[model samples]
Target: MKKQQGLSVIAILLVLALVGAGLMLVFKIVPVYTEYGDVKNALTALSAETNVGEQTLRQEFDGKANVSGVTSVKGENLMVVAGAGSNYLRAKYQREVPLFGNVSLLFHFDTQAGQPPAQ
Candidate 1:
């Protein structure tokens, strides 16, 4: 019997299917993470601002989130915690992405920004 030198049709199909699934996942998940990064940077900038109040922070965050297309968490959802000598801004949210049929992927993000200069 002669040995087959290349991949069979079944093997090629299976490999292609896996690659397609992986690419699909990347396409679906990359946007969410990109938005998360935007939100994080916005929060960090807000934290760094001096003399900015909660209301101002919320307004800024809302604008930034809108521009960044971050729908997972809104400015109203941000938690402003006051510590002994500093304050912190926290955002916690989740994103659900539909994959194949009823299958879905869930991503949870929790990010915090502390006062730029903690005294």
Candidate 2:
């Protein structure tokens, strides 16, 4: 008789469990990253505009954030930097996402408009 050519029942169940865990992580983590994108877009847009006051920048970011459904970084968290020839908007924040019981993921986000993204 030929040897078993496919996964055993136990092996299949283990694979399924691993796949389920991966899917759960993706579902939980993707939304947070999406919100980060929204935050970055808001910063980029604000940085492109000509604004003199930090308060104006923050207010503009808040409006964009509200429309974008971004909750990770708020307008109050933004920093206004005056560069040589232009002004930039930056946001630095961290998020703690709870996984299963006591296990959580920590994410650090720092974004500066008019500059390359942080790696």
Candidate 3:
């Protein structure tokens, strides 16, 4: 009897299916992270600037979000933390992405200015 070579048909199909699923997940999650980056940048920019009132911060964040095309977290979602010298902007939100029939993925994002992004 001849020895089996490389990957069999079943193995190849299984590998392909796994790869496809991984690709789909990446494709679905990448955009959310991209938007999160935008949100972080906006908050950092706002924080670096002069300290302002909470309402002003919200308005500023809204403008920045609009310009940066960040739709995941809006200005209203931001929480302004007033400090003595500078202000901190915190954004906490959740995103639900439907993968396949009745299956969904949930992502929780918590980002703050002058700090690192949270998962």
Query: TM-score per candidate, in order?
Result: 0.86, 0.85, 0.82
Candidate 2, residues 7-106, lDDT tens digits: the string is 9999999999999999999999999999988888788777776635777788888898899888777778887864444567878999999998999999
Sort order, lDDT high to low: 3, 1, 2
- Write model 3 residue lDDT over 69-102, tens digit each, in one string: 8877888888886554677889999988899999
Pitting candidate 1 against candidate 2, the one with the higher TM-score is: 1
TM-score of candidate 2 to 2 decimals: 0.85
Using TM-score as the yardstick, the better of models 1 and 3 is 1
| Prediction 3 TM-score vs. true | 0.82
Top model number, lDDT: 3
The lDDT of each candidate is 0.84, 0.82, 0.84
| Span of ten consecutive residues with least summed lDDT in model 1 | 79-88
Q: What ordering of candidates by TM-score runs from best to worst?
A: 1, 2, 3
What's the distance in Å from true for residue 55, model 1? Answer: 1.2
Q: For model 3, what is the alpha-carbon lDDT of residue 38?
A: 89
